[model samples]
Target: MTPIGTQELDRELKKGSAELLILSLIEHRARHGYEISKLIEERSGGVLKFNVASFYPLLYRLEERGMIAGRWVEKAGQRRRRYYKLTAAGKEMLKTQRSTWRDFVHAIQVITEAENA
Candidate 1:
Protein backbone atom coordinates (compact mmCIF):
# COMPACT_ATOMS: atom_id res chain seq x y z
CA MET A 1 0.00 0.00 0.00
CA THR A 2 1.12 3.54 -0.70
CA PRO A 3 1.83 5.75 2.28
CA ILE A 4 0.08 9.12 2.59
CA GLY A 5 2.30 12.14 2.75
CA THR A 6 2.20 14.40 5.79
CA GLN A 7 0.55 17.26 3.94
CA GLU A 8 -2.18 15.04 2.57
CA LEU A 9 -2.75 13.48 5.96
CA ASP A 10 -2.96 16.86 7.62
CA ARG A 11 -5.40 18.18 5.06
CA GLU A 12 -7.63 15.15 5.34
CA LEU A 13 -7.63 15.26 9.15
CA LYS A 14 -8.45 18.95 9.22
CA LYS A 15 -11.22 18.61 6.67
CA GLY A 16 -12.85 15.79 8.60
CA SER A 17 -12.34 17.23 12.08
CA ALA A 18 -12.74 20.99 11.68
CA GLU A 19 -16.49 21.17 12.09
CA LEU A 20 -16.47 18.77 15.01
CA LEU A 21 -13.72 20.76 16.69
CA ILE A 22 -15.50 24.06 16.31
CA LEU A 23 -18.87 22.74 17.41
CA SER A 24 -17.42 20.92 20.39
CA LEU A 25 -15.53 24.00 21.54
CA ILE A 26 -18.58 26.25 21.44
CA GLU A 27 -20.79 23.58 22.92
CA HIS A 28 -19.97 24.81 26.41
CA ARG A 29 -19.71 28.58 25.87
CA ALA A 30 -19.43 31.25 23.24
CA ARG A 31 -15.97 31.90 21.82
CA HIS A 32 -14.48 34.19 19.25
CA GLY A 33 -12.67 32.87 16.20
CA TYR A 34 -9.24 33.51 17.64
CA GLU A 35 -10.19 31.88 20.90
CA ILE A 36 -11.56 28.85 19.13
CA SER A 37 -8.46 28.51 17.01
CA LYS A 38 -6.20 28.92 19.99
CA LEU A 39 -8.15 26.41 22.04
CA ILE A 40 -8.01 23.83 19.29
CA GLU A 41 -4.26 24.30 18.96
CA GLU A 42 -3.70 24.20 22.68
CA ARG A 43 -5.92 21.21 23.23
CA SER A 44 -4.38 19.33 20.35
CA GLY A 45 -0.88 20.18 21.62
CA GLY A 46 -0.28 22.30 18.54
CA VAL A 47 -0.99 19.47 16.15
CA LEU A 48 -3.97 21.40 14.73
CA LYS A 49 -3.89 25.05 13.79
CA PHE A 50 -6.41 27.05 11.80
CA ASN A 51 -5.53 30.35 10.20
CA VAL A 52 -8.07 33.15 9.85
CA ALA A 53 -8.65 32.48 6.20
CA SER A 54 -9.74 28.92 6.81
CA PHE A 55 -11.33 29.49 10.21
CA TYR A 56 -13.68 32.37 9.52
CA PRO A 57 -15.26 30.74 6.49
CA LEU A 58 -16.10 27.60 8.46
CA LEU A 59 -17.58 29.70 11.24
CA TYR A 60 -19.65 31.63 8.75
CA ARG A 61 -20.82 28.44 7.09
CA LEU A 62 -21.95 27.00 10.40
CA GLU A 63 -23.74 30.26 11.19
CA GLU A 64 -25.41 30.27 7.81
CA ARG A 65 -26.63 26.75 8.40
CA GLY A 66 -28.19 27.86 11.72
CA MET A 67 -25.94 25.49 13.61
CA ILE A 68 -24.30 28.32 15.44
CA ALA A 69 -25.12 31.92 16.29
CA GLY A 70 -22.59 34.72 16.33
CA ARG A 71 -22.95 38.07 18.08
CA TRP A 72 -20.67 41.03 18.33
CA VAL A 73 -19.64 41.56 21.91
CA GLU A 74 -17.93 44.70 23.09
CA LYS A 75 -16.20 45.08 26.38
CA ALA A 76 -15.33 48.29 28.19
CA GLY A 77 -11.75 48.32 26.94
CA GLN A 78 -11.50 45.54 24.42
CA ARG A 79 -12.60 45.85 20.84
CA ARG A 80 -15.76 44.18 19.64
CA ARG A 81 -15.41 40.46 19.07
CA ARG A 82 -17.85 38.18 17.35
CA TYR A 83 -18.56 35.26 19.63
CA TYR A 84 -20.10 32.04 18.43
CA LYS A 85 -22.32 29.71 20.42
CA LEU A 86 -23.91 26.43 19.51
CA THR A 87 -27.63 26.42 18.74
CA ALA A 88 -30.08 23.61 19.47
CA ALA A 89 -29.44 22.28 16.00
CA GLY A 90 -25.73 22.44 16.63
CA LYS A 91 -26.13 20.41 19.80
CA GLU A 92 -27.97 17.71 17.91
CA MET A 93 -25.40 17.83 15.15
CA LEU A 94 -22.62 17.51 17.66
CA LYS A 95 -24.16 14.36 19.07
CA THR A 96 -24.47 12.80 15.66
CA GLN A 97 -21.01 13.87 14.58
CA ARG A 98 -19.49 12.44 17.72
CA SER A 99 -21.12 9.11 17.08
CA THR A 100 -20.00 9.15 13.47
CA TRP A 101 -16.43 9.95 14.38
CA ARG A 102 -16.37 7.21 17.00
CA ASP A 103 -17.62 4.70 14.47
CA PHE A 104 -15.03 5.83 11.95
CA VAL A 105 -12.24 5.48 14.43
CA HIS A 106 -13.45 2.06 15.49
CA ALA A 107 -13.55 0.87 11.91
CA ILE A 108 -10.05 2.13 11.29
CA GLN A 109 -8.84 0.44 14.45
CA VAL A 110 -10.33 -2.84 13.36
CA ILE A 111 -8.71 -2.65 9.96
CA THR A 112 -5.33 -1.70 11.36
CA GLU A 113 -5.49 -4.43 13.99
CA ALA A 114 -6.25 -6.99 11.35
CA GLU A 115 -3.32 -5.78 9.29
CA ASN A 116 -1.03 -6.09 12.32
CA ALA A 117 -2.31 -9.54 13.17
Candidate 2:
Protein backbone atom coordinates (compact mmCIF):
# COMPACT_ATOMS: atom_id res chain seq x y z
CA MET A 1 0.00 0.00 0.00
CA THR A 2 1.04 3.53 -0.67
CA PRO A 3 2.02 5.79 2.23
CA ILE A 4 0.29 9.08 3.05
CA GLY A 5 2.23 12.29 3.54
CA THR A 6 1.78 14.58 6.57
CA GLN A 7 0.06 17.29 4.50
CA GLU A 8 -2.32 14.79 2.99
CA LEU A 9 -3.15 13.33 6.42
CA ASP A 10 -3.80 16.77 7.86
CA ARG A 11 -6.13 17.66 5.02
CA GLU A 12 -8.03 14.41 5.36
CA LEU A 13 -8.40 14.83 9.13
CA LYS A 14 -9.74 18.36 8.72
CA LYS A 15 -12.19 17.34 6.04
CA GLY A 16 -13.46 14.42 8.11
CA SER A 17 -13.73 16.04 11.53
CA ALA A 18 -14.12 19.77 10.97
CA GLU A 19 -17.87 19.72 11.36
CA LEU A 20 -17.66 17.45 14.37
CA LEU A 21 -15.15 19.74 16.01
CA ILE A 22 -17.25 22.82 15.38
CA LEU A 23 -20.43 21.19 16.54
CA SER A 24 -18.88 19.75 19.69
CA LEU A 25 -17.41 23.10 20.68
CA ILE A 26 -20.67 24.99 20.21
CA GLU A 27 -22.52 22.29 22.04
CA HIS A 28 -21.24 23.63 25.34
CA ARG A 29 -21.92 27.30 24.67
CA ALA A 30 -22.30 29.87 21.95
CA ARG A 31 -19.05 31.23 20.49
CA HIS A 32 -18.02 33.53 17.70
CA GLY A 33 -16.04 32.31 14.74
CA TYR A 34 -12.66 33.41 16.00
CA GLU A 35 -13.32 31.92 19.38
CA ILE A 36 -14.28 28.64 17.83
CA SER A 37 -11.13 28.52 15.75
CA LYS A 38 -8.95 29.49 18.67
CA LEU A 39 -10.51 26.88 20.92
CA ILE A 40 -9.97 24.17 18.34
CA GLU A 41 -6.36 25.19 17.92
CA GLU A 42 -5.66 25.54 21.59
CA ARG A 43 -7.50 22.39 22.53
CA SER A 44 -5.62 20.45 19.94
CA GLY A 45 -2.34 21.97 21.18
CA GLY A 46 -1.93 23.90 17.93
CA VAL A 47 -2.13 20.83 15.77
CA LEU A 48 -5.40 21.88 14.10
CA LYS A 49 -6.22 25.28 12.73
CA PHE A 50 -9.05 26.63 10.65
CA ASN A 51 -8.73 29.59 8.33
CA VAL A 52 -11.46 32.20 8.00
CA ALA A 53 -12.00 31.50 4.31
CA SER A 54 -12.88 27.90 5.01
CA PHE A 55 -14.47 28.35 8.43
CA TYR A 56 -17.11 30.93 7.62
CA PRO A 57 -18.51 29.04 4.68
CA LEU A 58 -18.83 25.88 6.78
CA LEU A 59 -20.55 27.83 9.56
CA TYR A 60 -22.97 29.34 7.05
CA ARG A 61 -23.73 25.94 5.63
CA LEU A 62 -24.49 24.56 9.09
CA GLU A 63 -26.82 27.49 9.72
CA GLU A 64 -28.59 26.83 6.45
CA ARG A 65 -29.00 23.19 7.34
CA GLY A 66 -30.66 24.14 10.66
CA MET A 67 -27.90 22.39 12.59
CA ILE A 68 -26.79 25.60 14.19
CA ALA A 69 -28.08 29.14 14.69
CA GLY A 70 -26.05 32.31 14.41
CA ARG A 71 -26.97 35.70 15.76
CA TRP A 72 -25.32 39.06 15.79
CA VAL A 73 -24.80 40.61 19.19
CA GLU A 74 -23.61 44.00 20.32
CA LYS A 75 -21.83 44.51 23.59
CA ALA A 76 -21.17 47.69 25.51
CA GLY A 77 -17.97 49.35 24.32
CA GLN A 78 -17.28 46.50 21.96
CA ARG A 79 -17.88 45.67 18.35
CA ARG A 80 -20.76 43.40 17.43
CA ARG A 81 -19.99 39.76 16.85
CA ARG A 82 -21.91 36.86 15.48
CA TYR A 83 -22.19 33.92 17.84
CA TYR A 84 -23.19 30.39 16.95
CA LYS A 85 -25.07 27.87 19.06
CA LEU A 86 -26.23 24.38 18.45
CA THR A 87 -29.91 23.88 17.80
CA ALA A 88 -32.00 20.84 18.63
CA ALA A 89 -31.19 19.37 15.29
CA GLY A 90 -27.56 20.10 15.93
CA LYS A 91 -27.70 18.25 19.22
CA GLU A 92 -29.16 15.25 17.49
CA MET A 93 -26.58 15.47 14.77
CA LEU A 94 -23.81 15.69 17.34
CA LYS A 95 -24.99 12.52 19.05
CA THR A 96 -25.08 10.68 15.76
CA GLN A 97 -21.73 12.03 14.70
CA ARG A 98 -20.14 11.12 18.00
CA SER A 99 -21.35 7.55 17.71
CA THR A 100 -20.09 7.33 14.16
CA TRP A 101 -16.72 8.71 15.16
CA ARG A 102 -16.38 6.29 18.03
CA ASP A 103 -17.15 3.40 15.74
CA PHE A 104 -14.61 4.59 13.22
CA VAL A 105 -11.97 5.01 15.88
CA HIS A 106 -12.66 1.60 17.31
CA ALA A 107 -12.33 0.01 13.92
CA ILE A 108 -9.02 1.72 13.33
CA GLN A 109 -7.78 0.66 16.76
CA VAL A 110 -8.73 -2.92 16.13
CA ILE A 111 -6.98 -3.00 12.80
CA THR A 112 -3.85 -1.38 14.18
CA GLU A 113 -3.74 -3.74 17.13
CA ALA A 114 -3.98 -6.71 14.81
CA GLU A 115 -1.21 -5.32 12.64
CA ASN A 116 1.03 -4.75 15.67
CA ALA A 117 0.33 -8.15 17.22
Candidate 3:
Protein backbone atom coordinates (compact mmCIF):
# COMPACT_ATOMS: atom_id res chain seq x y z
CA MET A 1 0.00 0.00 0.00
CA THR A 2 1.10 3.55 -0.58
CA PRO A 3 2.16 5.39 2.52
CA ILE A 4 0.33 8.65 3.13
CA GLY A 5 1.79 11.67 4.86
CA THR A 6 1.69 15.43 4.58
CA GLN A 7 4.14 15.61 1.72
CA GLU A 8 2.72 12.51 0.10
CA LEU A 9 -0.79 13.88 0.26
CA ASP A 10 0.41 17.16 -1.13
CA ARG A 11 1.98 15.26 -3.98
CA GLU A 12 -1.27 13.37 -4.48
CA LEU A 13 -3.15 16.65 -4.60
CA LYS A 14 -0.69 17.75 -7.26
CA LYS A 15 -1.84 14.94 -9.52
CA GLY A 16 -5.31 16.39 -9.42
CA SER A 17 -3.89 19.87 -9.69
CA ALA A 18 -1.97 18.82 -12.76
CA GLU A 19 -4.82 19.83 -15.04
CA LEU A 20 -4.97 23.35 -13.73
CA LEU A 21 -1.20 23.69 -13.75
CA ILE A 22 -0.96 22.40 -17.29
CA LEU A 23 -3.68 24.79 -18.42
CA SER A 24 -1.91 27.65 -16.68
CA LEU A 25 1.29 26.75 -18.48
CA ILE A 26 -0.38 26.45 -21.88
CA GLU A 27 -2.11 29.73 -21.25
CA HIS A 28 1.33 31.23 -21.46
CA ARG A 29 2.45 29.02 -24.37
CA ALA A 30 1.87 25.60 -25.87
CA ARG A 31 4.25 22.79 -25.00
CA HIS A 32 4.87 19.18 -25.74
CA GLY A 33 4.19 16.60 -23.01
CA TYR A 34 7.86 16.32 -22.12
CA GLU A 35 8.19 20.09 -22.04
CA ILE A 36 5.24 20.32 -19.68
CA SER A 37 6.84 17.67 -17.50
CA LYS A 38 10.15 19.48 -17.54
CA LEU A 39 8.61 22.84 -16.64
CA ILE A 40 6.79 21.39 -13.65
CA GLU A 41 10.02 19.85 -12.41
CA GLU A 42 12.01 23.03 -12.98
CA ARG A 43 9.44 25.48 -11.66
CA SER A 44 8.84 23.40 -8.54
CA GLY A 45 12.56 23.27 -7.82
CA GLY A 46 12.66 19.73 -9.15
CA VAL A 47 9.92 18.69 -6.77
CA LEU A 48 7.22 18.07 -9.33
CA LYS A 49 8.01 15.70 -12.13
CA PHE A 50 5.28 14.68 -14.51
CA ASN A 51 7.40 11.89 -15.77
CA VAL A 52 6.01 9.69 -18.57
CA ALA A 53 4.38 7.20 -16.24
CA SER A 54 2.33 9.91 -14.55
CA PHE A 55 2.11 12.46 -17.34
CA TYR A 56 0.97 10.76 -20.51
CA PRO A 57 -2.30 9.27 -19.33
CA LEU A 58 -3.37 12.65 -18.01
CA LEU A 59 -2.47 14.26 -21.31
CA TYR A 60 -4.27 11.70 -23.38
CA ARG A 61 -7.32 11.92 -21.18
CA LEU A 62 -7.36 15.70 -21.40
CA GLU A 63 -7.30 15.37 -25.16
CA GLU A 64 -10.06 12.80 -24.98
CA ARG A 65 -12.09 15.24 -22.91
CA GLY A 66 -11.52 17.97 -25.49
CA MET A 67 -9.82 20.08 -22.89
CA ILE A 68 -6.51 20.02 -24.74
CA ALA A 69 -5.41 19.16 -28.21
CA GLY A 70 -2.26 17.36 -29.22
CA ARG A 71 -0.39 17.11 -32.50
CA TRP A 72 2.93 15.80 -33.62
CA VAL A 73 5.61 18.25 -34.55
CA GLU A 74 9.13 17.68 -35.75
CA LYS A 75 11.74 19.39 -33.63
CA ALA A 76 15.48 19.77 -33.57
CA GLY A 77 15.48 17.72 -30.42
CA GLN A 78 16.30 14.05 -31.02
CA ARG A 79 12.93 13.27 -32.67
CA ARG A 80 9.38 14.41 -33.33
CA ARG A 81 7.21 15.08 -30.30
CA ARG A 82 3.55 15.43 -29.47
CA TYR A 83 2.65 18.88 -28.29
CA TYR A 84 -0.35 19.95 -26.23
CA LYS A 85 -2.25 23.20 -26.19
CA LEU A 86 -5.22 24.26 -24.15
CA THR A 87 -8.57 24.35 -25.85
CA ALA A 88 -11.13 27.07 -25.20
CA ALA A 89 -13.00 24.71 -22.90
CA GLY A 90 -9.81 23.97 -21.01
CA LYS A 91 -9.22 27.64 -20.23
CA GLU A 92 -12.67 28.12 -18.74
CA MET A 93 -12.58 24.82 -16.90
CA LEU A 94 -9.22 25.57 -15.35
CA LYS A 95 -10.48 28.85 -13.96
CA THR A 96 -13.43 27.16 -12.34
CA GLN A 97 -11.39 24.25 -10.99
CA ARG A 98 -8.66 26.47 -9.57
CA SER A 99 -11.16 28.52 -7.62
CA THR A 100 -12.96 25.44 -6.28
CA TRP A 101 -9.77 23.75 -5.20
CA ARG A 102 -8.49 26.82 -3.42
CA ASP A 103 -11.78 27.20 -1.58
CA PHE A 104 -11.81 23.55 -0.66
CA VAL A 105 -8.30 23.61 0.69
CA HIS A 106 -8.99 26.77 2.64
CA ALA A 107 -12.13 25.33 4.14
CA ILE A 108 -10.36 22.17 5.14
CA GLN A 109 -7.56 24.07 6.82
CA VAL A 110 -10.01 26.30 8.65
CA ILE A 111 -12.08 23.41 9.90
CA THR A 112 -9.08 21.48 10.98
CA GLU A 113 -7.78 24.48 12.89
CA ALA A 114 -11.11 24.92 14.60
CA GLU A 115 -11.10 21.29 15.64
CA ASN A 116 -7.61 21.61 17.04
CA ALA A 117 -8.61 24.72 18.95
lDDT by residue for model 1 (1-117), tens: 999999999988998999999999999999999999999999999999987898899999999999999999999999899999999999999999999999999999999899687
Off by over 4 Å in 2: 1-3
- Kindly list the per-residue Cα lDDT of model 2 for residues 1-117, writing each as its tens digit: 989999999989897899999999999899999999999999999999988899899999999999999999999998999999999999999999999999999999999899687
Instruction: Please give the TM-score that candidate 1 achieves against the real structure.
Output: 0.93
Question: Which pairs of residues collide in candidate 2?
Answer: none
Ten-residue stretch with the least lDDT total in model 1: 108-117
Residue 72 displacement in candidate 1 (angstroms)? 0.4
Please report, in order, the local distance difference test score of every candidate based on alpha carbons.
Answer: 0.95, 0.95, 0.85
- lDDT per residue for candidate 3 within 1-117, as digits (tens), equals 876999778878888789888888887677988788888889999777766887889989899999998889886766988888889999888889889989999998999899687
Model 3 regions lying over 4 Å from their true place: 1-3, 6-11, 112-117
lDDT of 3: 0.85
**Cα RMSD (Å) per model?**
1.7, 1.4, 3.1
